[model samples]
Target chain A: MDEPEFIAALRSLPLHPGARNLEDDCALITIGNETLVINHEMMAEGTHFRPDADMADVAWKLVASNISDLAAKGAEPVGVLLGHSLGRDDARFLQGLKEALLAFNVPLLGGDTVTATGASTFAMTAIGRATHHPVPARRGAKLGDAVYVTGTIGRAMLGFEGAAHHRAAFDRPEPRLAEGLALAPLVSAIMDVSDGLLLDCWRMAKLNNQTFAIDPDAVPVADNARRDECMRWGDDYELLFTAAPGAAIPVAASRIGKVVAAGFAPLVLGKNAFPTADNLGYSHG
Target chain B: MDEPEFIAALRSLPLHPGARNLEDDCALITIGNETLVINHEMMAEGTHFRPDADMADVAWKLVASNISDLAAKGAEPVGVLLGHSLGRDDARFLQGLKEALLAFNVPLLGGDTVTATGASTFAMTAIGRATHHPVPARRGAKLGDAVYVTGTIGRAMLGFEGAAHHRAAFDRPEPRLAEGLALAPLVSAIMDVSDGLLLDCWRMAKLNNQTFAIDPDAVPVADNARRDECMRWGDDYELLFTAAPGAAIPVAASRIGKVVAAGFAPLVLGKNAFPTADNLGYSHG
Candidate 1:
């Protein structure tokens, strides 16, 4: 509906516990002592994925990508709502979707579907449960805590270059749910490495009012091709987190760097944080 | 990215409550005490919307559509999550999205974003609360319950006929959030009117194991179309429900017909129920 109608509709809702009001009802998950709400993100063709990508991978990746967000927050994925275009509803596509849901353990609750007047578009809203473990908010890193990554980075980037055995990396990046769950109770703050390591690090730093200094040698690279390009390309789906210096990490986390009280914005040794602007993860309109 | 890797990535998720385990997650959100746990829906380009549609309206309609589902359950809208694709990150689009979030009074909690390989898509997961209400479900209509709908139907079908005013109806259909909330504690079973009247009614009947009969004359139609054509077209987004005989409806609900104990299939008042090989609702494959 138009803006007025939308406003009218929202105003019409009766307040529920924790909703406060319509404007605050973004995410509806119960996290820690509060509820986590969410909204919509639109994905467009030719940008979020390669047009020739396998239909099944497209469907699985779509669900996996969203579930990773909940994992980043250490929130347990509850259900998903989808806003899908018409072309992707064929039997093959649905088969892929079923596989993805089964694989991730996230259920398809309910949602709306419509036809398009142009290119296809897809969007989804995923809900999760927030528990006693810290919610791993973006703004909770401490000054002296060390920054760590749950798994290796750059594999997905290498796959983009057609490197041998790298195709799988690019096509399907793992969602660090276990690592997130294990780290949730320990990490000061956390986020997923969907964007390039350098860029995402900068984001965490800015959010925490801290800076990250990474030792290039210590950064885990899947292979040689990925060693360089992965620094620029994004979509690794690893967990980047910060923890206290003396803390014991539950997962097999690699020490990427140390969080400093103040420094040049999230640097990789002496270089600009991300080096590339246009290729900083994926952008949607 | 491919099927195997995609499956591996998805299989990596840890078990959670709503997920019910990573393998069988797509079940409809049905919680303890018969409480419908959540509402899910999807919006996609070229299927649910027009490319040239106003970004603000698109955002608003997206939220409205999902909320309407919760309203149908007579459940309180709790929060939402979004899945977005990256193609073009236009400032205007973000602005419109923010405006819709603010207008809807639902907070923009959290979501996932991925670059797409094809058209754009937007999906929403809206979790609602209905602890005390019997939580109107789709399969609750019984014999002799009156079939009814809140507001008009077939407007969206007619709205799709042209690129001007009619498109508005199609582009931005109002989600009767208030009407749904008002009726939540009242209806025997509830459902939103996304598919055409005949198709959705049939679905409701099937889900409830009852026969739903909608009088053709009682069906609502928009101004732009012929009677018969409109009858077949869906996208109305109204609330269709069944109530016990002599039960009073709070909103402007039209009395269509009654649920029958026998006659398992959904039927028109005078004609035989058409069992088409093809489903009548919009398919997103």
Candidate 2:
């Protein structure tokens, strides 16, 4: 089976009620009065990074990407359990791990470590406590709602362009934990843009049975001359959500689009509609 | 850093107060009155299994090992979150994953999956609720305690000897969950022997600051001719424990040893003493 087929097969297995059919970024489980949000992510040498990539940065990216999912749920991190395959540059990897844990102020829970050969892999599970009720999901957007995003788009793609000053954006993109927590109480729908804004917006719209109509002039970009490329490229680690018009936004973000009634296309780029969501986004795989 | 150094470096990082400095096999956390046992394990190609090995068994072994950790803690399986790196044989892996979850009665929470180029790796987090107070750890053995192990030892080693009858023992070793729950309240110390019985005994002795004197003649083996080799070989999933001399030895285990006061050696093989735990067992690295 391929990735899609494999995932579909897994959907048939017995799952906890909190799993949400494996559609959401974070799984929700209620223990006592608290709602726990959990996310797990894995990164590898050849697939997620170059063989010669800085081990520290690789570790940082692993932690940040998982944390971003928690941020999308507006959850505060409890700790992370790590599973590591022993290989080269362990010292460098540890350094990067320390930096990310300290930067996010999340504790490191115990996990197993085993020695392995060929193509080292790293995985981590981040557990968090939800700060708001009815914890935000990507399918909660309403018709005629305003669409917004945190910070600018395409910074990671710019970092990939070999600019010395732009490198950290790609190496150590910060998860918007604070903004997510702030936005959770106000927004109807929210998710992080791990994939490109266009693709993620399309996903949110499709799940909500609405259409995201983004204005090319209003959408923020890393470089105005390459606007289309910036909107389509991903890895910016920005929060994207929908709120009622004139609602108070607690974080510094840009209002770039509106949620319209369901249409033939899930996403409309300017006046023209994309044929499919898959055709508009960049996939590292 | 190697495995030991890598673990030491992780100690310096900021962790939750309950992380226990990575001492216990599973991280212990209390949510309200519920004590949670969490463990994550990763298996890979080449190092963990043969590149050509059956993908289904590989997935089975991964889930069983983590479940074994829960069993050691006298905890019932709550659910598991899986982190998988995409590669070949995805269908077989999912089939095995389904079987293991059904066998153990565990729910699949949620996890992340990424496509990777080489060396497919699988990681899982098993969460459970403790059934007994002061959950068992390796550091609870006491002086003059009688040592026992549930079921016979070294059967897995015999499985490696081309015996079709014994092959299943090596392929899918059952975790002693029920036996552990039955023995938890009465035993002074208890642990599942994943490594060789001798090495695990030494580790428990060292952690408790005592010495274990085991009679080689009383120790059960797969065969008399291969007794010595069987005692040294690992992958036997049996519970090893210590209790008051004749405190109704609960399970169908043999009484093989006694825990003594602090001594120069942590383990005594018949009359000869082994200086360190690492020297007595297997090292896959």
Best by TM-score: 2
The per-prediction CA RMSD against the true structure, in angstroms, equals 6.7, 1.7
TM-score for model 1? 0.77
Q: Assess every candidate by TM-score.
A: 0.77, 0.96
- Candidate 2 reaches a DockQ of 0.72
True contacts kept of each: 0.39, 0.76
Please give, for residues B151-174, the per-residue lDDT of candidate 1 as tens digits. Answer: 666677767777475676676666
The reply for model 2, stretches above 4 Å from the true place, is: none
**Regions of candidate 1 where Cα sits further than 4 Å from its true position:** A1-28, A31-44, A81-103, A110-124, A162-167, A224-226, A268-285, B1-37, B83-104, B112-120, B154-172, B219-230, B271-285
Worst 10 residues of 1 chain A by lDDT: A18-27
DockQ of 1: 0.28
Q: What is candidate 2's lDDT per residue for B1-285, written digit by digit as tens?
A: 577777888999987876888877788777787888888888878767788877888888888888988888889888899987777587788888889898888989988787876778889998888888888876678788999987767888888676787787788778888888888788888888887889888888888889999998888887778777777788788888999996996678899999987679989878888777666777654
Give the CAPRI class of candidate 1.
Answer: acceptable
